[model samples]
Target: MHEVLIVGGGTVGLSAAVFLAHHGVRSLVVEREPGPQVHPRATGVGSRTMEILREMGLADAVNAVAVDMKGISLGKVTVETLAGADFTTMSPSAQVYRDPDFTPARMRGTCPQNRLDGVLLGAARERGATVSYGTELVSFEQDDDGVTAVLAGAGGTRTVRARYLVAADGVRGAVRDALGIGLSGPGVLGPGINNVLFRADLRHVIGETRFAVCSVTTPEAPGTIVTIDGEKEWVFHTNADPAHARDVIRAAVGDPGLEVEIVSVLPWRVRAQIADRFSAGRVFLVGDAAHAVPPLGAFGMNTGVADAHNLAWKLAYVLRGEAGPALLSTYDEERRPVGALAMEQALLRLADPRLHWDNDPAMAAERARAGVVNAPVVQLGYRYGQAVQDLPSAEDVALDLDGSVGSRVPHMWVADGVSSLDLVESRFTVLAGAEDTAWASAGARLIDGWPYGPLLVRPDGFVAWRGTTPDDLPGVLSRLLHTA
Candidate 1:
């Protein structure tokens, strides 16, 4: 039996497969599609997600093809009348206006969904995870020891056994349904349409700015026009009747004579949802299979990637017998609340009309002021309090000034010119202030008798524990090693 079985081969599933393989665990991935499909979905990869990808050895490659967005423009609309709106009223955008921290590494990059899938698939293959494409999961039965899956693949129907199963299947998860888990929260909230692909000339039609421009066609129809790969693409969310939405879009461009080719039209409903629970027996859920958020803050894919990171190390520990099965329980506790928080933020952003307006001088000034105070960090700075329950309190836990988790670790530059994220590669790390021989001895003892490698690290670059320490090491290790 394989050590782990992952359903779906999208961002989350591939990420998990790569992490598991890095930890010396064998995994199998079942994908319904023959290959990754290009969807006009989330293209902006935030700094935090980039940090995670850097650990997977893909930062440079992903950066090479990404379109950098320098800033964003906001506007407002009345029914059938587009007008200049102000952004200064929105706290999130206002923060960006003040600090204006736009470094190359920290800046956001836009990589189309297809390109992202390609990069992840290649990473998964290099890590030695077995990926079966065009495979369908019929059902799965899990017991105390393992899970047996019935799948239909190129060779036809077959049964495969695995120690654990992870469902990364997008929204409609066959595994979750088979396990009788219902998705909690509002399933969908109206229709949104996005059209993407290549076009010859868009610069002449729109101004040359590295910002995502928002135009309000009417109070009911709000649209965002973004430049991707030198082409102009449109994402329109409208309250108007679906039948007339396209007509409204055609008129807004104001040039029937302009030559524009439509590549793909994607119409989907926004969803704010989470699973009642993340696990049942030996089966667990991750990615869209567990939670789905409205694509407002670009949290959906990033959250899924974080889920993979959280679960991978824990599973590796349990399989190797370093930690008890109880450690697995922390996964749900940590990631579920993160998903809920992201969903709440996304819905809040979508509901705020002032966020989309940039034309009003008063509103624009307000947005600029708010941007200085509140930024995109709220979605990026989430932490796992549940995982680090034993962590000593230095200060009372409170949201950061930007409204994010205070205890959440900050991503800084790599100390020795290496990426700061490189420290987390393939093992548990304990970050202390400086090198401590006592902590090292404790860590070594814990891992020597145990199964997996345990690292005692510091907030800075000091190795507190190489693997051995004595004073209350187990208690420290237990608290630090818990996975999100």
Candidate 2:
């Protein structure tokens, strides 16, 4: 029996396996597809998600192949046509995440879903996680002990047992539907759009204003030209027919003279939804299974990756017998709200008039004055919430760690040329002050010379508890982590 069984080999499931492997937990990732798709579906990876990858020790491998789209200079320019009059440029996406001030270690990267899957699969396998392709989860039955599931693959049908199961089966989410879980909020956010993948020498046309998304406002072929390689390989998102993709590409690029070769076309719907429940007993939903946000601003995948990270540590400790089973319930408590919040924010961003070539000036001005920009804050600055209904908050005071108990610990430097984040990924730790405060709790590291006093930082980098002396450590762990 594997410690964790993950359904679907997309970014979320792969992430779950890698994260579990970081804690020496073995996972089996069963993917329905024969292999990874070479589709440039989700092109954006947020700064926060990058931080989590670094902790899992997959950052360098991922960053090696992940393209950073920051060099693309042109913002969203509202143009009448690909070759016609130009309108005001839309607000540029925030690059603050790349700056050292915002994050000490990680930066955002633009890698296609398929490429990301390969990277994650490599990392998981390298760390001893089994990823089986062309394997489908036929059915799973869960009891108070564990989950017994039947899997169908090329070889034949087989049975496996796992302590926990993660459902990352995507928006349609067969597992979620089978479990009779419901979704809340808007089902379909907008009309169905087609993504046409093609190749053309658009470098000359793009010039210095290389953009990730360029809006073509002409009635001939209204769509956004998305750069896949920050170059010629692109995806045209429009309402036009697939057969007319070549012409649509030429029209959007404003270059009838250039030859465009159509690669692949995908038609998909945009949805804004959050699952009513993230988990039912031992089966938990992650990524698109838990929430479905529009593809714009790259919120969907990043939020899903974060969901996997939040659940990975808790699941690992509980399965390892280091923490009580009560810790598993906190997974839903912590991540469900995040899914809802990301969905809501993604909807607002999708509705942002600035993203469109033509917009109501009055509404834009009001939103601008209201400081309605949440891309950075929503992506990175979000803190964790109360895990359980009666989780204590008395001595759970916020310290130097982001000024909140449930919030992530702020990134700082370590004495060994590593990051403070690098120090806490292995297990729960208590960093004491330089002045020698007695904070010796079992399984907690007592380090001196911290700028602040004693702080109980969790393996996930969130402040679990804090105190001045050793006496406060044990009770805090019992309450926050529910350690046995």
lDDT of 1: 0.61
Candidates' RMSD to native: 7.1, 4.7
User: How do the predictions measure up, each by TM-score?
Assistant: 0.77, 0.88
Pick by lDDT: which candidate is best?
Answer: 2
What TM-score would you give candidate 2 relative to the actual structure? 0.88
lDDT of 2 by residue, 1-484 (tens): 7789999999999999999898888999999989877767787777678778788777777777765645444434556665564322544443222444444445444666777788888889999999999999999999998999999999999999999999999999889998999999889966889988888876576554555566788778889877677667888889988988888778777777779988888898889988999999999999999999876567789999988988898998788787888888888888887787677666766776443222344543554453333354555556677322122221121222353577676666656557666767557877655455344434444444456566678887777765656766667778776863
Q: Report how far off residue 66 is in candidate 2 (Å).
A: 2.5
TM-score of 1: 0.77
Residue 311 miss distance in model 2 (angstroms): 1.0
The ten-residue window of minimal lDDT in model 2 covers 388-397
